[model samples]
Target: MSDHLPVLKVRLFGGFSASYGEIPVSFGRNTTTKAMKLLQILLYHGDTGISRDKLLDELYGREELADAANNLRVTAHRLKKIIVDAGLPSHNYINIKKGIYRWDAPMPTEVDAHQFVILSKDVQACTDKVKKLALLKKICLMYSGEFLPELSGDEWVLVESVHYKNIYSESLQELCKLLIERGDYEEALRFCEPACQLYPFDEWQSVRIDCYMALNRYKDAVQEYENTAKLFFEELGIRPSEHMMQQFEQMSSRLNYKPQELGDIKERLKDDDVRGGAFYCSLPSFRDSYRLVSRIIERNGQSVYLMLCSITNGKGMPMDKPDKLEALSGELLNTIQQCLRKGDSFTKYSPSQFLILLVGTNKENCSMIFDRIQRYFSREHKSWKQYLDYFVSSVAEVDRQDSPIQFNTENKTW
Candidate 1:
């Protein structure tokens, strides 16, 4: 019946909306109504009508209805009215025969979720790599997010969402592998950006780093790794996996400095804004600075100290309250920034701790610096309950092969 009608575009993934030949269809605010649920179920199942018995159990299974069959008929009427009210030609939108109800709309319907499943199936059966890659790209990008997230609480919706999510995951993984094999690293990297946004916890950045390495974009790979690793640490309270660590180590080994003019090199390395008392950098950059400074002191015979400032409660224990820790961390950053010199640098190591590099400073000066920070913090915050603890290590004293930054998380060593 819908074969001769104009196309109806129905978007189910991410959210629900429908438009037919420039005419919009509104389900109103209450999509949880039995009428809208019926439409959703019928639209999902397509031409294969759902059995009346199964439909009743899903629609009003928990209700104490005296006449559920009549209620279903009323809902069907409402659904039909909704279709015609949307400016479409009126017809028998709900077809029922042999006690099976199906969506028989006036116009042909094309749902995004259904199209994605169909394309994924086609890609699986396709033997030609060329055609398969094209299909894979189309389908992989078709998925934006979970199916009908607004109806995620519905058990049926949850089940269907998981199915669709698995298909998206598998399709994207296959596409990335194929692209990598074809040496299309740039294209693979482009695909990874959306995947990362949709499913950030899925570690798509690892594949992205691989693509960067394949394209010899070492600088981009390192930056991506640092940003991703920092995200995992700050948000998830976790470190990188062994695989990512190994990749970083390989990148480190492959590093080589090319010949360049001193002026150009100096311009690239210069800090444009040096107004602050202390330089705050990423942990990775801080690590490089520490390594370079450690090596330099061996020739110049200078004193430097690495200090760890940890926030502790009244009982001298680590801060556990998330809100309190976050607030105090910001205050601590300000306190340390004001205490250190412009020649020094620092980085955040954890939620409640900061690692500071004290340049051209002796052991006595390190102790005085720690005292200054602690005293300043106590004076600033009138509450005066928590105290700061400091642990200092001489830069030239530690073993080069195994430096002072030795904090382990789970099975990985950082």
Candidate 2:
């Protein structure tokens, strides 16, 4: 081991990062993506020394490389050079002996993922409850995020990523269980919040909802369920799992939200003129609103229009690039909210579009509303004025007989 560089620290949870002693090691622009993957594989295998054939398979997969052996050698050399240039002793750091390639460091190595695994095993194996709880807390805190979060679509990385995530989830469950049992709902929430944010699995949300309920924050618990349901249905077009729905029902049933009397309701209604910006709601909420509004409109023979505003590039054609679409979508959302009535509601249909329910409006009034939105959006997004369009659907009631609510796209564009 070199005296100056005593340790080589490797972080693999969130992304791959390497450091020697107190100095950070960076593979600059000159380094190829394959070089980084090759180094990560060696580091993951540790001193076990992966076979050259296995390395070639992982690096190239089924794709035929013209000169794979030479490519591997060059990549390994580059990996070593990256470390040597970053102030680490590189001689024998990455070596090929016989048919196996190994990353043998003279300096001590500390990999965060490896540390997480070790701490997790220690927690499981410890006989003393106090020591085990302490170790569990340590393991929970060590996992910052999923393993190699940036390496998507690679089969080798995905397998390892799933394995690490499974372990992380199990650790969180165990840690939260202990904390909650000790009446430490606040500390338990700390773990649950990150787990739900990163993973959003039913199990994590279940624990989080339980934490909020434990602290007597019933409203927060209900909101969490609503957010969870909205996320599942909006993103995947699937309902929340039965387990999550059950938890929500149990929490909501215990709440003491009393319905207001007629006089109280009248006073509350007086405060809400319901003639300004459209009500912003989640997709599920919008679905319920659509159903109720459709029934009401049918009973009263009133007109309602659903408009879909999407981004475009001056020619009234849809924009496909996500970044530009998102920027324009935000501006459109702000504009639509400002130009519509308070009784009207809108929901995000996707990153690039919105579903707006315009109440009590005929075709001409709908056109006027569209004109207002365009004018507001033009002022708010001066740069994007030439790069956006809104599609105002024909003003009609949502067909109650239709299985799924369908928007009539036969209409004018602005």
**For this target, which candidate reaches the highest lDDT against the unseen true structure?**
1
Alpha carbon deviation, residue 344, candidate 2 (Å):
36
Could you tell me which 10 consecutive residues in candidate 1 have the lowest summed lDDT?
261-270
RMSD vs true structure, all candidates: 15.7, 12.6
**Candidate 1 lDDT by residue in tens digits, 37-58:** 8888888877888999989976
The residue-level lDDT of candidate 2 at 153 comes to 38
Q: Which 10-residue window of candidate 2 scores lowest in summed lDDT?
A: 261-270
Residue-pair clash count for candidate 1: 0
Candidate 2: how many backbone clashes? 1
How close is every model to the real structure, measured as TM-score? 0.58, 0.60
State candidate 1's TM-score.
Answer: 0.58
For 82-186, candidate 2 gives per-residue lDDT tens digits of 767767664768867899988788888888988888998897788887888899888778787767765533546645665676688787788888889899998
Residue 225 lDDT in candidate 1: 75
C-alpha lDDT score of every prediction, in listed order: 0.76, 0.71
